[model samples]
Target: MLRIFVIVIIANAAMAQVPFLGTCPNLEAMQNFELERYLGKWYEVERYFAWFEFGGKCVTANYSLNENASVKILNKQISSLTGVATSIEGIARLIGRSDDPKLTVTFPSLPLPFDAPYWVLDTDYISYAVVWSCTNLGVLNVRNVWILTREPKPSVAVVEKAYQIIDKNNISRAYFIRTDQKNCPVTN
Candidate 1:
């Protein structure tokens, strides 16, 4: 009896829908992404908040090629709630081929784990990048967007370029929260 009730609750949570600012079909992923050039550190300048990443500040992602031909993803953040640094490591594998920017990422240590899309929408490889991913729940959508930069803070021009791609997809900029990159503690 208790087991059945627990299953029902978990089912409802799995079917939860995230509120979005605009209506549109899934945006297309960028093509011909340079795998080597894209492998590096990227600072999260802004992002649309997700439940798993709420209250995270000074966020950054480091990507490196692994021996298995997959990419190792290290995501680091400063937790506002606990005032501590936190990080998670995951693996990203190319979906079908090396030329495409579409990939799937998974955290093996996470419970009830699943592979999630990690699509690159646009990138300059020098200054900024725009990434988008979404999961469908019936007619609703749960999506995430990230504006990443080569530096902790990006120039206005760099940010504007990313915004153009965001606007093209009809993703509301209002949902994006600017990540705090000021006066960060030095890491050894």
Candidate 2:
């Protein structure tokens, strides 16, 4: 009886950290994403904080096409605690076909497979992009959502549209944490 009780407690704790269970049929990636237009710097306006990104502030991602036709992803951030610049580089392989926003990123530093889905859920190309990714962990799904913009802060209306896209994906808005890009001492 005591062993069963312990198992129940462990299960609940695991569930609490998991983002969601099962698939979201309504959550769809962009039909067509222009690679050229998306090739630039993007500031992280908001996101559902992943464990790896804890204590990171003024985060930004820069994308460029490599000679091998893969996308080079450079993620940079300032440590909120120590105020130092830190970065990680990853390469994203285009999954399935061209023009599709689905990708799988692999980081050399990480031993565990970094081959996670990189889906562009919604993007205007020029201004804002809503990206989503999910992977099954045991019986539950761990999800990551990011709201990125060409500028540090997009207009409220633009952000509202991004939120609508997230809502359509069935992600709870309560989980989002707004990134602090204001007064970031670091420059490009």
Candidate 3:
């Protein structure tokens, strides 16, 4: 009985993963914090979507602040299929946090659209970039993800750090897939 109880506790502990929605480790607060600050454009540095690699080719993002106080996000995923580059566009809206400085994002076009909510988990004012995740994205499907600054892939240390944040926040991590575009290491 004692051993079974201990196993259950350990199993629960292992399954509790989340993202860090707190402030940056070295920075005090985000810069140009207005929703406009999140506007303009962004590229997928790394994501957790496996079936989509929906990456590769050339991926870019565009955003505009909407009148409803939502960030109008336009994500274009360009990938080569059988030597032809194809693109898929997606629209994401901020669901949680309007003034708290944090944002939880959701896509209204995908199959499970509103299900895998992407949270603008955290960021650093100094780096001009941010970290994002979905506590339910991965667990729900094979399309959970994260977006970042540019085309260049993140460093090993950065990946570990992001994992740490997710570990502490109970974010989903299943079926996570890192891309292999011009910016990432060759992981087959």
TM-score against native, each model: 0.86, 0.86, 0.52
TM-score of model 2 relative to the true fold? 0.86
Where is model 2 more than 4 Å wrong at Cα?
1-18, 23-26
RMSD of 2: 4.2
Whichever of 1 and 3 has more lDDT, that candidate is 1
Better of 1 and 2 by TM-score: 1
1-188 in candidate 2: lDDT tens per residue? 99788667546434433356664334678887777788889999988867667778889999999999998999998888888889999998889778888888887787554476788888998889998877654445667789999888789988988998988877788888889897776566
What TM-score should be assigned to candidate 3? 0.52
C-alpha positional error of residue 97 in candidate 1 after TM-score superposition, expressed in Å: 2.1
| C-alpha lDDT values of all predictions | 0.81, 0.80, 0.48
Q: Where does candidate 1 stray beyond 4 Å?
A: 1-17, 20-24, 186-188
Prediction RMSDs, each to the true structure: 3.3, 4.2, 9.6
What value of lDDT does candidate 3 attain over all alpha carbons? 0.48
* Best model number under lDDT: 1
Ranking by TM-score: 1, 2, 3
